[model samples]
Target: MKNYLSSSQMTLRMFAADLLVLSSILSAAWCLSVLNVSVPKTLNSTSGSCLLIPCLFNISKEKQNILDSSPEVTWRRGSLWSLYDTDGFTIAHRQKEPVMEVVGDLRKKNCTSVMRNLTSLHSDRYYFRIQAENSGVTGTTAVHINVSESVAEPNVTVPVLREGEEVNLTCTVPAPCPSHPPNVTWAPALGGDVTQRTHLNADGTQSVSAILNFVPSVHHHELKVNCVSIHPLHREDRPLLSHKVVILNVEYPPKETWISLTGLVWLGDNVTLTCQSKANPPAVHRWFMKRAGVEEELSISHVLSFTAAHENTGEYICEAQNLCGAMNSTNLQITVLGISFTAFLSILAALSLIFALLAIAIVMIYRRYKEPIRSETNQDQNIYANMSASAVKSEQLQSKPCEDKNTCTINPVYAFKHDLPDENIYANC
Candidate 1:
């Protein structure tokens, strides 16, 4: 009888252990069931734009075993007001009639709905409920849809250009909605469609540029070009942002032409010339000279010295240019002369000495060859003197008594002749 009691006690202990294990398993399953359900609290969306309200949920382990078929998902606002009533919100099972349409694939358990053409009236709290078999659960999410009255204005940037250069205007509309993209158009302030080309960006926001390649005239100065953007909601036809006026002031250097003193320039000469041309930006004056064989630009002051020679001559050209245009002066020919005074004086002094020597030689030759002639009366007087002396001696001996008388009569008579005749041959022989 004691042996029988021991076997019964062992069986009772095993039964008690089995009951405790079942209780613990049931307690764990109950805790998991409560954690499976969740509800969203907030919704985010931009003002004056579309909103996508997501109804996201996951089945818990406890709820997974309860349903073999898809659960019925229903969308509502506030309390029981239904937004979408269908079977699990699936595309195939969804009721054809719904308050709002669902975009993208809805079968993959993605309960996301898009509210397009949203207005201020659609702003409110929304609720999503799931019903399966005999169990029903509800989750709540708040959607704040702000419908703004005005849209953002676009930005425009114009390229810098000189007058007469082609103008390419670009308009950029940023962060635009795909459903209602901004429309871009261009118009000139001067009237007429001067735009030549256009371009668009991939995003609903666009980049539109108009190329005006025409040569700008003075009439277009200070002209304003409008890059207008129109939205589906905008009532005005004008542009959202008016770009600043671009005044193309294409300036070129001043053009000038003058008589250039180029080529071989003799010393002591000035190179004078004139320059002519037209430009937006006036050109500058720069005079340069290059020697016949040299390749460098000679300095203005240094080019032709006050003593310029033939070697100083060379080809010359003037360059005039600015941002708009360029021009050059015509080539000029230059001539230079050389002069010295010292060389002339030396030649005159030599000729004067030669003339003096010739005059003296002629005078000496004439004096040495000529002879003087005397008169015939001078020779006859000499012979008469000798005869008178001999007669006087004889008379002295014969006549002592008449000495006194004769001496008185013959008292030494002397004769003088002042004139000589060149006709007589014996004048001075």
Candidate 2:
């Protein structure tokens, strides 16, 4: 009876051991069912370059213990295949060198891998697998890789730019391989400084970005900005290059204010002055005149027009303003030409005075010449009278001695009214 009890006890113990083993097996199978891998659904890579495929996995506690002891991580091409099967080809393994390598730590459940020297032929769906002892798990989700000969264009991000304001411009490109990151450069090199960074995406791919920081100005407005990326593949061949362009719209204050004249201005002439400036959002113009060291506002519009006068002859200035700021133009001098009415009248009066003085001098000269001619005529008449008197006196003296008594009576017509000495009268005869 004791022997029979021992046999029954052995059978019961064996059944109990079998039940525990079955329960453990069931637990492990459930754990394997829950195992999941995280990776990007699609990835792009340039031919002859390198690609980095980031990966992670999660496992149950029971599976973790199993994988912790001895873990083997691998990557394969084709849909959901394992090392035991001939359905797929292995591209990366934890051990041994292949076309790709599992760079992540298998102990930490990271399944990241790097594929180097890729070509168009390497474009395919890839899978991740983890094995521990006799138990293994294969992820259902696969990563599809698309390889192309030309690199993709980089992404450029720009914000609203304002004059004198600091800003940052971002240029981003896919960085498939960290070790062989693409070289990024800026065309026209518009920034004060540039900074580069590498970051991982939620997906398996990584990205590299170049940030340019600068202060914008009106000069930069409407200018095109270019972001260029060069991906190095093989030293024997030319590298792949991609570029993107964006036009800048910079907001700024008024600048380079100036005044332009249609033609030379003269007194009482119709003239126009046009004010101009460079600015975003346009600009408002104001005209001013600096006369006698005082500035006076003229017009509040883009153009200032009026009849030019003496008051308008001074330094002219134009002011351009916007929301940002204001600027003044260099002094533009305006001169009124031609003589004034008052000055012309003054000159005419002076000329008339000169003519009057010349006429007075001519009249005085004519009066002086007439006086000399009259004096000569009077002297000649006096001399003729004296000669006639002398001839008459001689005749009288000659006849006086012979017929003194008879002549004195008869010749009353030729009477001498003055008393003359008898001796002087005789001597003259």
Candidate 3:
């Protein structure tokens, strides 16, 4: 019995501990649910621009026991406390009664409201109050409204256009305007009014446009257009954003011209030439060959099939013209190979004839000098013959010196001729 009681006591103690943990968890969950039932705390806006302030709250339970239509939603700005009112603070569907003239929608069960057409004076802390039977359970949300004085500016875009093409001008504002709609005006670049259109947003903001529909002219290209946005609250003619310019560029004519080599052809053969021009309406190309004393216009293909000669070796002009302007090409040279070859042969023949004459002149001069050389050779032979005879006579006289002893003496007349005693030759004679 004692062991049984001890076991029972231990079981009871464990049950009590588990119950305590469950109670703590339930308390924490309840605190979290209460904390999650509050509204968002801040809101912001720009000056001179329209804004929407949202008032919303969160509820913890899904029970439908709470009436969806009885919660009251109220909004206050600065020291003023009565701007917006609704039936239910946590209900999703409730009718709204707004004290301000601004247009907005209110949701009751969700406990949220949107205020539009905000101005700079609306910059303040806004408080929301809800009336319910469970007064302490009702939630309040505080919002800080930030309003600036900078107004919305319009955007403009320009595109490259062509003649007779329709041009569109669009102007877009950055944000919606709650207080007043902006007026857009269009004036021609030169100074004239065109058709205009306007579009409105549900928030009371507006966008306007102007269009000029006419065949684009050079005059229009040089002119400018204006996009003006006038604030309704401001003075008439005084646009908050004014005088945006739009310039139009139109494509009309091709601005380039060119020509290319067709191919090579033999002498007396036919060849083709081509001329090209770039223009909007396409250009007309004319080919002219400056032959001897004539400038004949060739056909569109400009294929001159005549036998090419030296006379045809002049400038061939390709003229391209369009409605806008005309351009001419440099003269192309056409050469005839037959004429070139003939001229080369003539030069070689003249050189051969000159060389033959030079050879004949050299042969005649050699023949004319040959006879005088032969005569000089004969004279030299005679002088050698006389010297030999004198030498023979002197030898004979020297041998016979015994017969004529006195003759052996040297002779003064011939002493210079031989290195011998002068008495010998003289005595022999």
Candidate 4:
């Protein structure tokens, strides 16, 4: 009978112990439910970097008055099941030394926390806990953290572009997170020509892509095409995270060609003329000269260098061409400071030839006229001498009027006059 009585008393004491423990648990639950914490369920960040978590706490206004003017906030890295888990370390605390470092103000009811030096191994949930001093109230919230490796530059695929042909530049990058992906933007943005899309990856990630489409021209040659990613967890200076840039390999002919020559060139001076143009397939150049409205091809190269002289002076032109067509530069008039010695000698030789021809013509005419004038004067003098002799003979014949008729010849003057057939000559005799 005494053993039965002792067992009954022990049973009662055990029941009371159970009741007291249940009462204490219920009171704690009630207090915790009143102090509520709100925060996002999931957040993403990059590995080897920092993460900022937004948090807020709410409690009855009555409790606010009762609590200490200065409340305390703490952050620890653990799951909800490990509320009192001492294995978890405190990363941040209000008015106390932080685990690493925090960069926000909590006095103004900002419960935001910053996690630093995070890695893929840090892929765990964190909890925020707040203490209202003397009010015997506290709130807690959970934050699921996803830390991924830093982004890599996008893969680029671009084909060589032919003139007037359409082409595309494609770039792809692995998404930073499955829930939160980075945005893609093209460098030197092409309006209405950019295309973007995304694909789901097997490892709970996404692959984002962008493409630029256009018809290539010579103007597009050597231009850089870039695909840039803007990351959510990037720093201020490094807002853009990953990128890929490639030079456009477009092919076309020469354009806007031109030649350049020194102004006011002088004779015997070293001269250089350059042929310049914009082209994709690199234009082959040649130099030319235009004189007397005629073209003279000079060189088949980009530059023309020579010593200046009168012969070299003219309208100089540079012709640049590729597979497409020919392009000519504006004419540049090259003038010399003075005439060269060779030019002076050439002029003197021409003048000497003309003078020699004129002198030969004058000598030929003088020789032809000198003989005729001299012959005519000799004939006139002989005629005058003959006439004088004839007159003297006629006087003698008249004085010897003849008796010897048989042997007499007619007066020679009379006989000559009979044959003369001129009345005036007969009277003179």
TM-score of each: 0.32, 0.55, 0.37, 0.38
RMSD of each: 26.0, 19.2, 17.8, 22.3
Ranking by TM-score: 2, 4, 3, 1
Poorly placed runs, candidate 2 (over 4 Å): 1-33, 69-71, 76-98, 159-168, 187-191, 201-204, 213-225, 246-251, 263-273, 286-318, 330-429
| Candidate 2 residue lDDT tens string, 68-186 | 66667767566453323442234332222227788988777788998887877778887777767877776767899888888889999999899999999999999987888898877
Answer with 1 or 3, whichever has the higher TM-score: 3
Q: Model 4, range 272-345, lDDT digits (tens) per residue?
A: 88889987678899888999899999889988999987888789888888876678888888877695546667
lDDT of 3 at 266: 47
After TM-score superposition, the amount by which residue 109's alpha carbon in candidate 2 deviates from its true location, in angstroms, is: 2.3
Give the poorly placed runs of model 3, Cα more than 4 Å off: 1-147, 189-206, 211-214, 234-239, 255-429
Specify the highest-lDDT model's number: 2
- Report lDDT (CA) for all predictions: 0.48, 0.80, 0.54, 0.69
Model 2 TM-score, 2 decimals: 0.55
Quality of model 1 by C-alpha lDDT: 0.48
